[model samples]
Each structure stands twice: as structure tokens, then as C-alpha cells.
Target: MEIKEHYSLKEHHTFKIPVQARYFAEARTADEILELSRHPAFRSQEKLVLGSGSNVFFTKNFEGLVIKIAIPGIEITKRQDGYAIIRAGAGVNWQELVDWSLQQNFAGLENLSMIPGTVGASPIQNIGAYGIELKDVCEGLEAMDLESGEIREFTAEECRFGYRNSIFKNELRGRYAILAVSLKVSDLSAPGVTYRPTASYGDLKTKLEAMDPKTLSPRLVSETVSEIRRTKLPNSTLLGNAGSFFKNPVLAEERAKQLIKEHPQVPWFKDSQGIKISAGWLIEQCGWKGKRVGNTGCYEKQALVIVNYGAATAKEILAFAYNVQSSVRETFGIELAPEVNII
Candidate 1:
């Protein structure tokens, strides 16, 4: 719980954006978080909760306290009726939890592999990918109200999850800090193979049949997912990135139909509300793939990912993102919002 001033945030975030935190502290336990809430300095200023810092872009130096969550632990509790409830600390790495779930023979998080960030941040954004979302497996979560230092539990419904959005990013915004999350996983293999990549591997039955039914293995699923992710996303170690830069824009049915007439090759998927068009496809069609301005560029293989080739500033990257957004909007008349949080 050592508080440091003028801390470098380059290593903290996946984008490798060079920014400084005016004040920073690592909370190893819930008590430390509670204590900090009562501190006069923290109370007077704004606070930022940082996990692995994967889903955030630091545009400039933070003027307030940056609480880096370092709490750790994963406990499997209450196994009954072929399901097990697992509680994980907020600081636990998201991918590690997915790996752990597979190791314990629990099925549910296999589809969301290789996503960057921490367990606590999952519920905040209701992170989703490849036809699966955090809310689908999340049972509940405990968070500390930063103002009152009181712990509160939120059920799945209360979280109000919707396409990379949750209560934490909306109504609850900066009021609370997530402490831990409890998830329900089942022994029965309920594989989600509807996504194109997963389905291309094989049908659900074929993939499951390959595994040993008598003895379940989470490792196999993790490995498969890891391999798939590696093939698609740029490795953060080799190239600086935060996966997808913007969310796919959802269009009204009539507008989607009009666009379909114009671009016959455009790919789309139907959600409950409307049709979601592929942002990557839109960017690629706009000729942004492999386009670079200084050290920042759009990935050649995946147009959705904005990469830092070498020395790139946060402003430069953002400028490139805005250019992409402008192009997409001009082409489709739809505004694309960034998925990464900019601060």
C-alpha cells in the first residue's frame, strides 16, 4: 500500500501510452481500498480504478489518485447439481481465470479467451467476444462504494449488461470499486461454438467428441482458444495494442437493408435490437489496413486493431482512430465509438 507520486503508466496499459499518474497506490486488499476512500486527499480528488489497464488509453497525465488493484486469489466453492460457484479476486488476470475454470473442469468462459484486463473490470464493461459475454456466466459481484466505503452486492440483472456496457460504466460510473466476482460454471459441457472461428474448427459434437467425456479438461479448451486468438490478434509483447479499437456499429433494420443494397459483400449479424456491421470490414473497405502515420498504424491482418510500430504518442494514435471513425461515418453515415476508455 505504498503511495507514489508521478508514476509512469507506460507499463500499466496494453496500449503502452506514455502517461503519468499524479498519485498512485496499489490496493492488495479490500481494507486498503476502504482506508483510501476515507483519506482526505482521495476524498477531495477524483479516483481511477486500474486493473491490468488493457481496456484504457491514457491521453494525458492523471490529476487524481490511480488505484491499481493488485488483490489476488481464486476459490472454488459450493459444488452442487453439476455446477460450481467460483469466486475470484478483482485483481486476478482475466485470462488466468478462464484457464483456471478449464483446469477445474468447469465449462463457461472458454469462448472469451485471450481477452486482456483483470477479473474485476469484467463486470464493469460486461466484456464480450465470440458470441459470449461476462453476464452469461456471471452469478454476482461485490463492490465497495468509494464515497461511503460500504460493500454492496449486485445481481446479474442489476448490472444492466448490454454490448460492452454495464451499470459500472453508466449509472454507477465512478461511485464504486469492484472487489470480487462470483461465477457459476457447470460440469456438463455446454460449448458455445456458434462463432465463425469456433464453428470452422468443427461442429459442437465433433469438438466435444474429441475430448475425453469421462474426464473433463479445461486446458484443452483454453489451448484451442489461445491458438485461435493468437492467429487473429497482434501479440502485445511484439506490438503494442489493445485488441479492437472500436465497437461494431449497430444500424437500424431499414438502414442496414439500404446499406446491403450498396455493399453486397458487407457482413452483418442480427442482435435483439438491430443489425451489427463489422467494423473491421468497414475500415478495410475504407483502405485503412496497413496504413500508418509515423509509428502508429492499422494492423495489416486485422483492420480493427490499431498498433504502435515503435515510438507513438497517445495523441497520434487517437488522431488515427478519429480518421478511421470519420471515414466509416462518411461511408456509412454511422458513428463508431471507441471501445477503449480514453482518459
Candidate 2:
């Protein structure tokens, strides 16, 4: 792996934020990652492991070593009891793995299809959509402790997954580099395969049924979800963006009840911790949807997405987001938290 200095980061991230890294390198295997730990700068320089840069917003140039995990491969290491354990490299594209799983008739990841970033980043964010979350299918993962150069395996339970959160984001943040993730998926071709495709969340049922597929299968769900997303979200290639800038605020049951009573039009879903209210609906109600302010603004199609019209600095993005937050906090007595990692 070649390490470069003062590297331009414009192409690495979907946001297209014009930023540079003081030091940058890509690791294609676990050995390379351990090699990175032995580098002279490893112990002295601030370090960060980056994936596809799909879920981060660089507010400024990073004055640290940025190690990009590029480990690759996807294979089923175990199959039994009508199920199989598929292990994927952290560097593998998330959608590619999803498509592969579908092609092999492995069921589980269809709902998470089209999500940006790499497999290495999945467990970090506990990525989910429609209904199923990564925690639901993840069997385990192997990560190298960047500090010690020792590899450790983490079970799904040990990952401590919450809504869009995991232990990787909390107790273990920045300490380990994910090398590979293993997921258990139902073998649809096996006799008496009982895995049922989920298409009941949000408008999924409506759209899936509209397609009129004879069998509501993983392939159909993947395509339907992708189609729905394409219509609601702008392509990052044309417009710079990290999808869903803010998370749907999870409100307590009583607070949710009161809010629902007061604002009957706001959409919501139940969460294990609380009631997840639509951040997009709230932002739209605040009149920020499609309202471009300087270089950044909420996307016209979905208020949850903040887009860069042409040139947008990280400071400008933050300013616009802060304004939106102020409006929401003042109007609804709730604080808006950003989902994107601001750095």
C-alpha cells in the first residue's frame, strides 16, 4: 500500500467536500492494517480509519493519518440447518454484497440494499433500513486493534446495537479496524426454507404489491427499495450529499403522544427505546425543505437530506444545519441531532 501526503479527499466521499488529509493510505488486507500500526506515524499521529466516506462530513482538513480499509472478498464459510454464514471483507461494497447474497438466494440483507459505504463501516453504524438491521443478520466480526495490532472477534450481542448505533461508535470508537464481517442468512433454495421476505415497513408493502411479483422475494424487495430511494434521493454523483443528515429523533412515549395529539400530521414509528418521529417532516414544517440558503440547504425531495448546490464549505453546511436546528428547537421544544459524523 502506498501512503501519500496532502491527499485530496474530494473523490473519496459522497459529500464531495473539498478537504485534504495530511497523510492517507489504503490497506487491502489485515496484515497491511497491522503494518500500518507499525508505521512511524502510527503511534505519534492522530489516526482515523475511513470507509467509503458515506456517513461522514469533513468540516476541515484532517491533520492525521487516514487509513482506508480496502480488504476484499465474500464467501460462505458455513452452511447448516437451512442457513449459511457468509463472511465479507470490510472493503467490499455494501450493495455488492447485498446483490451477491440475493444472487446466491441468501436472504437477510435485501432491506439494506443500496446503502452507501463499505462492509467495514456497516457494524460501526449498525446500518438499517425498511425493517431489518445489521444486528439482525450479523453473526460476528473480526477487527484488528489498531493500537495493539491484535485481532479480536466480536459477536453481534457484544456489538451492542441500538438504532443506528453500536459499541464501535461508543466504547470502542477509533480503537479497532474492522477486517471482515460474518452474517447468517437463510438459504432460500434449501428444503423447507422458512425465511419470509419483509415488505411491510413504511410504503414498502404498497410499492412491492404494486409491482405484482408472484413471490415477494429478496430480489423484489431490493429492487423496490432501490427504486423508492432513487425517486426520493438525489444521486450523490451529480449533487454532493451524505444521505439523511439527521436522525429521526426518538421521543419518549408521552412526549410522542403529546406531539401526535398536537400535530396530527407528523409521521412516526415505534422504537424499542422510544417513538421515532420524522425529522424530514419536522424540517419541512419549518419551511427548510428545498430552501437553499447560500451553498447548502435541505434537499427539495427529502428534508432529511442536506445537499450542496455547487460549492459548500463545511462551515457553511454547519451554519445552515444550525439554523434548521434552532428553528426546530424553538418551534417544537426538541433538539435536532446530526446523524453525519462532523469532523
Candidate 3:
């Protein structure tokens, strides 16, 4: 592992925010990560672990050791009870895993297609879409504790997943660097055996049916979900963005009823806690949708996405987000929390 000084972060992160890291290194193996953990700079300086850097925003340059997880591999480790266990290296692109699972006739993970990040980030974010989340198929994970430099394992229950959240995002945040992820998917090797896919969420069912395929499969679901995302969200390559900027705020039962009574037209659905209000619809109600300030704006198609239209400074983008949050709070008395981790 070669540690570099003053590395530009504009390309590392999807936001394309022009910033630099004081120190940077890429680890492609478990041993390399252990070695770096013992390095003098790692022991002395602050550290930030990155995986594709898709769900983060930086207000200023990170003056710390940025360890980019680049480890790569994917394989079906075992199969039993009609389920196949697929293990993927942390740095493997999330979309590629979904595609691989489908190609190998393993069922599950179709609804999560097009999510921009790596397997290492899946558990950290508990990424979800179209009625499915990473927690649904995740069997376990392995990570190297930065402080101990010892490899440890965690089961699905230990992850404590909850709607784009996990223990990794909370109590264990930054405590360890993920090395690999294991997923349990249905085995479809037998003839006449088909796995029931997730297609009931949003317009997924309708879109999938419109395709009019001979039968439903993981590949079909993946393609339909990918198509929907391509239409609703902007491509980070064409336009710098981190998908949804804010999460749908969940309110208590009584509070949700009150809000529904006041603004009955606003979109919402039942959440695990109570009612989940749509952040995009709320921003639109506040007249921030499609509104632009300098080089940043809400994407014209989806208000949930905050796009940096070439050359926007990190502070400018942050200020624009603050303005949106303020408007939502002022109008609906609802506090909109950002989903992206701001550093």
C-alpha cells in the first residue's frame, strides 16, 4: 500500500467536490488493511474509511488519513436449504453484485439495482429501494477493527438494520473497516422452480408487467428497477449528485394523523414507527423543487435529489440544502434531516 500526500478527492467522491485529503491510501486486501492500521500515520492522525464515497458530502478538505477500501472478489461460498450463500469483497460495486447474483440464478437483490456504492457500504447504509433493503438478504459481514487490527464477524441481527440505518451507522460508526459481505439468495438451479421477486413497491409492479415477459425472474426485476431509477434519479457521472439528499421523515402516530389532516394531499405511507412523509413532496410544497441557486439546485425531475451543476462549491451546496430544510420546517413544522453524511 502506497500512502500519498495531498491527494485530490474530486474524483473519489461522486459529488465531485474539489477537496484534498492530507493523507490517502487504498487497501485491496485484509492484510494490507491490518498493515495500514499499524502504520505511524494511522496511529497518529485522524482516519476516514471510504467505499465509493457515494453517500457523503464534505464541507472542507479532510485533514486526515482517508483509507479507500478497494478489495475485490465475488463467489458462491456454499448452498444449503435451497439458499445460496454469496460472499463478495467489500469494494465490489453493489450493482455488479446484483447482476452477478441474477446471472448465476440466485434470487434476491433485484430491487436494489442501480444503487451507487460498494458491498462495504451496503451494510453501513442498509440501502433500500422498491420494497427491499440490504438487510433482507444480508447473512453476515467481516470487518477489520481499526484499533485492534483483528478481523471480526457480525450476524444479520447484530447489524440492527432500520430503514437506511444500521449499527455501523450508529454505535459502531468508524470503529471498523468492512472487508466483505455475505448474502443469502434463493437457489433457482432446479427446473420449474422460480423465486417470487419483489415487485409490489411503487410503480415496479406495473413496470414489470408492462414488459410482458414469459415469466418473472431476478433479472427482470433488476432491469425494471434500474429503468425506474434511471428515469427518477440523475446519473452521478453526467451530473454530480448523491441520489436522495434527505430521507423521508417518520412521525409518531398522533403527529402523523395531525399532519395528514392538515395536508391530506401530501404523499405518505405507514412506516415501521408510524407514518413516513415524502421528503420530495414536502420540498415541492415549499416551492423548492426545480429551484436553482448559483450552481446547485433540486433536480427538475426529482426534488429529493440535490444536484451540483458543474463548479458548485461544497459550502454553496450545503447552504442550498439548509435553505430547503428551513423552508420545510417553517411551512409544515417538520424537520427534514439529511441522509448524506456531511464531513
Best-performing candidate as measured by TM-score:
2
What lDDT does each candidate get?
0.84, 0.92, 0.89
Clash-forming residue pairs, model 2: none
Q: Which ten-residue region of model 3 has the weakest summed lDDT?
A: 190-199
List ranges where model 1 is wrong by over 4 Å: 188-219
TM-score per candidate, chains pooled = 0.91, 0.98, 0.97
lDDT tens string, model 1, 1-343? 7999999988888888778999999998999998888898878978999999888888889999999998899998777767779999999999899888877767778777888889999998888776678988899999999999999999989999888789888888988889999998776433432211232232233564676664434455656666767777898878888888998888999999999899999878787779988889999999999898898999988899999886889889988999999999898788998888888
Clashes of 3: 0
How far is each candidate from the true structure, as Cα RMSD in Å? 3.8, 1.1, 1.4
lDDT for each residue of candidate 3 in 1-343, tens digit (9 for 90 to 100):
7998999999999898999999999999999888888987569777899999899998899998999999999988998777899999999999889888888888888888899999999998799888888889999999989998989999999999998789988999898999999999888995656678777776897877676566777887888888888888888988898888999999999998999999889878787878889999999988888889999999988999999999999999999999999999999899998899889
lDDT (Cα, 0-100) at 297 in candidate 3 = 97
Give the TM-score (vs. native) of candidate 3.
0.97
TM-score of 1: 0.91
